[model samples]
Target: MIPVVPLDRSREAALRALVDGKAKPLGALGRIEDLAVRLALISGREDPSFDKALLLVFAGDHGLNQAGVSAYPSAVTTAMVATLLAGRASANAFARVVGAEVRVVDAGVAADLAPHPALVDAKVRRGTRNAASQPALTPDEVQSALARGAAVARRAVEAEGFDILAVGEMGIGNSASAALILHRLAPAPLADCIGLGAGHDAEGLARKHAVLAQAAARSDASDPPGVLAEFGGLEIIAMAGAILGAAAARTPVLVDGFIASTAALAAIRLEPAAADYCIFAHRSAEKGHALVLEAAGAEPLVDLSMRLGEGTGALLALPMVRAAAALLSEVASLDDVLAGRL
Candidate 1:
């Protein structure tokens, strides 16, 4: 893993002063003011540019679905990838509204998909092994997924000139995998992390709980990479890589929903510095997401009772990100305002 340097705080005091001097009541912008400070810290500029944004939606399949963990079949993973590539998915719709370019990555879908220009072919395997009885990914596959995800992110920032990055995922049964990850990584109780992922009923939720217990019992690995290999979906691991990549590039990463936050947890655990670059997008309706966010000490930007896990929540927050940057760059200082410089 590439080491990420923590944001330099040499200018933090100065940035805060600048934000405070803006033509408005002190802290009138609420969290938006805090956001501007972070943006400045990331860009090394008092007036950071957040004009260009990219959304990476990683699609994969989880073999754990075979254990009746999800309400939907694993086949839905492939179908949703097609839906995203066709520009008809909720993520695509949200991206259009926010003016962020969307790219779908074939991280580890179970089936081969037809080639599409917008799709990134970074599949590490057909699908993860059922973690209920075995490790989901091999050690080598875990490294490959991380490297591929980093490559995708580096390309977006270095080649495509994207100013910010948001990561989302599509993997049937991934919520179960994410729950397992949060349970182990967050060190939260397994029952606390388990939730009605993809709308499971009472009986289905009970079954999910039992299967996840089996998975948890199968491994005692506590480190990030080991835990990821034990239970992470390909998309989840890839999203972790993307977060690391974005942080290494000194770009802000908008982590979306529960599965995405679980990935962020892995990245931050791997490199603690990566946590400084992440903006938790929203509080997902998924019950366990609150626990994951709490463990990370993250205050999400909004709560819309959404669990749609397609980067939609992140995209919806893009406007606020833009507003944060705008406040720093466009607003006048109190000194200038009093001088009638306008």
Candidate 2:
């Protein structure tokens, strides 16, 4: 695991004091106050600005889809990537409202996506092998995927001047893989981590149990990277690395629900320092999400029963994040009131 450059704590006490100095009564903003503090710490400044935002939808395929784990077909991943590229997905709608740029990544789609300006071709492979009986990706492929993921964030933040990043995935059946990954990383029981991913029915859930049970038994991922390489979808690995990259750049990273949280957990497991950069965007309708959120100690910014996995939750939360940053950077301080400033 690469060592993460830790968030600077020079302004830790001053930052909180400054947040309290806002014109409102202390703690009046609730979680919005927490969001402001977090954004401040990530940027390591008393004032943090988030006028630039990005939504990266990492698309991949899950070999678990070969089994009946999800209601949607595996082909839906590619089609949805196309939908995202066309700016017709739910995430795009939210991005439009929030004024965030949306970029689709071919992290590991089984099919070659047609060339599009909005798509960043960072595919590590066609898809991962079914973890039920085999490792998802070879160690080399996993390393490559992780590197690619980190590169995307680094490029955006360093070269393109991206301020905040929200990571989402478009892998059909990835929730099962996320469950498996969470089961290995967190102390929760395997059954506690399993959920009805992408609208599974009774038979589909039964199949999920049978196959994921086999995956748990077959996977021996003792460490964070091992867990990711052995059981994670390519996009999941990439998202984890992206979180790491954001932390390295000292930029806030919005973690979406369920599968995205699974990646956040992986990133934190890899380097605990990354947690400071993460702002969980929402809670998902999928079962076991609360448990994962608890394990990560994340209080989501919102909960809309949203289970759509395309950075939609993060997009919906973007405006709120921007507002928090705006308050930190532009809002009046108690000093202004003392000076009789309007």
- Residue pairs with backbone overlap in model 1: none
- Considering every candidate listed, which one attains the maximal TM-score? 1
The Cα error of candidate 2 at residue 226, in Å, is 1.7
Candidate 2 residue-wise lDDT, 155-266, digit = tens: 9999999999999989998999999889888868999999888887798788899898988898567688788888869999999988988888888898899999999998
How well is each residue in 1-342 modelled by candidate 1, as lDDT tens digits? 868999999888999999999999998989999999999999888778887999999989998999999999999988899899999999999999889999998899999899898899999999999999999999999999999998899889999899999999999999999999999899899999988988888999999999999999999988889999999699999999999999999999999999999999999999899999999999999979999898888999999999999899999989998999999999999999999997
Show where candidate 1 strays beyond 4 Å: none
Clashing pairs in 2: none
Each candidate: how many clashes? Answer: 0, 0
For candidate 2, give the lDDT: 0.87
Q: For this target, which candidate reaches the highest lDDT against the unseen true structure?
A: 1
Candidate 2 is scored at a TM of 0.97
